[model samples]
Target: MDRLPRLACSDPRLTRLIAIYETLAPATLGALEALFAPQARFVDPFNDVSGPAAIRRVFEHMFETVDAPRFEVLDAAIGAGGGAFLLWNFHFQSRDKQRTPRCIQGTSHLRFDEQGRVLLHQDHWDPARQLYEGVPLLGGLLRRLREHLAAR
Candidate 1:
């Protein structure tokens, strides 16, 4: 953690984004638009959406699909050209019969506009291991395939 670059408190945009994520919920989902520009783009393992409305829908789906999804920022950093990076964990319980809670480790790369609103947000994560492998039927098959591959 010591080696990770800390986002300065002065960076209001990034700070606010972090704050909202830490306390994110269905009601607060609307506020996420304030953190991004009107035409901002967001990309993740399963989504490629542009604009605040589209982005909000993704989060909405997350909440609707998962039991209790939340994000925890472990570290953050600011880069040149108003860019930022956030290392985080998404924890949730599957809505299916597999009600066990799980955690997905991921990182987000963000580019902000002059107003400190995000222009582009891209997330990096492994859906196969973090999500699909947790499913009941698919999980077993995926786990077996993973084991076979690892043996080689």
Candidate 2:
């Protein structure tokens, strides 16, 4: 369990959205429409999509690829103009039994419609280091490349 940061100004919509994310599951994906507008745009390292249906597909693929995928909201804040930001960690295990569990720290910027449903959702995270760098062979190559590219 993660501790939620105290919000300076509590927005019910943001609160509810966080709850949805923290408890999100395959069965509960249908609830996305309640949090996202019909034409909401969602973008991440590997996906750029519009509309709730497409967003749902992205999440569905996550479920298909990983075991017990979940999100822990570490911190959140509501902007003065109905926008919001969420800092979170995505936890999951690879379907491959040999791979250990993994966590990806990320942040999301969200803009809401007048109705409090999200219009835009953009995720910020580094997949090269957080994801690809964990592969056996590629990981070693990437690590060596990072070392060579290091400033100091």
Candidate 3:
């Protein structure tokens, strides 16, 4: 919430994050270390990575099959200070070519430390759409059914 970027690429910390996302989105293990303190904690529904080493492990395991990672920053707003959230569309290819380059839209909430390095990096997205639904066979259909019930 603090240390908001004025532009998606302006802040040094944000820049590092974007650079990592561009090159390592699916498999960015060690690259993340540069963004956080040695003991920083990162939490997502799938993982609660504590410390740099564990976070790196999560990234390494995540990148196992995801490839050709690319990001499209659709919209952003620069604040008076040094931070911002860019609505992003993350597209990538999986080893399962049948469902290659699936587009998953998400938001990365990043903050900077006093030194302007990323202190907190949080992400928000629909796990169903970005992940579960992208699986093969009944994935999409199953997601639809879940959505249908949730709407009730």
Q: Which stretches of candidate 3 lie over 4 Å from their true place?
A: 1-8, 25-29, 75-84, 97-99, 136-141, 144-152
Taking all chains together, each candidate's TM-score versus the true structure is 0.86, 0.91, 0.69
Instruction: Report, for every candidate in turn, its global Cα lDDT versus the true structure.
Output: 0.87, 0.87, 0.65
The residue pairs in collision within model 3 are 4-82, 4-83, 5-82, 5-83, 5-84, 6-78, 6-83
Q: Higher lDDT: candidate 1 or 2? A: 2
Q: State the weakest 10-residue window (summed lDDT) of model 3.
A: 1-10
Q: Positional deviation of 138 in candidate 1, in angstroms?
A: 2.7
The clash count of every prediction, one per candidate, is 0, 0, 7
lDDT of 1 by residue, 1-152 (tens): 22335445567777899999989999999888778899999999889999999999999999999988998887887887668899998889977665888888999999988888899999999888888887789999999989989955
Q: Write the per-residue lDDT of candidate 2 for residues 23-83, one digit (tens) a residue.
A: 9998999886568899899999999999999999999999899998998888888778767
Which scores better on lDDT, 1 or 3?
Answer: 1
Over all chains combined, what TM-score does candidate 3 have?
A: 0.69
Candidate No. with top lDDT? 2
Candidate 3 local accuracy as lDDT? 0.65
Q: What is the Cα-based TM-score of model 1?
A: 0.86
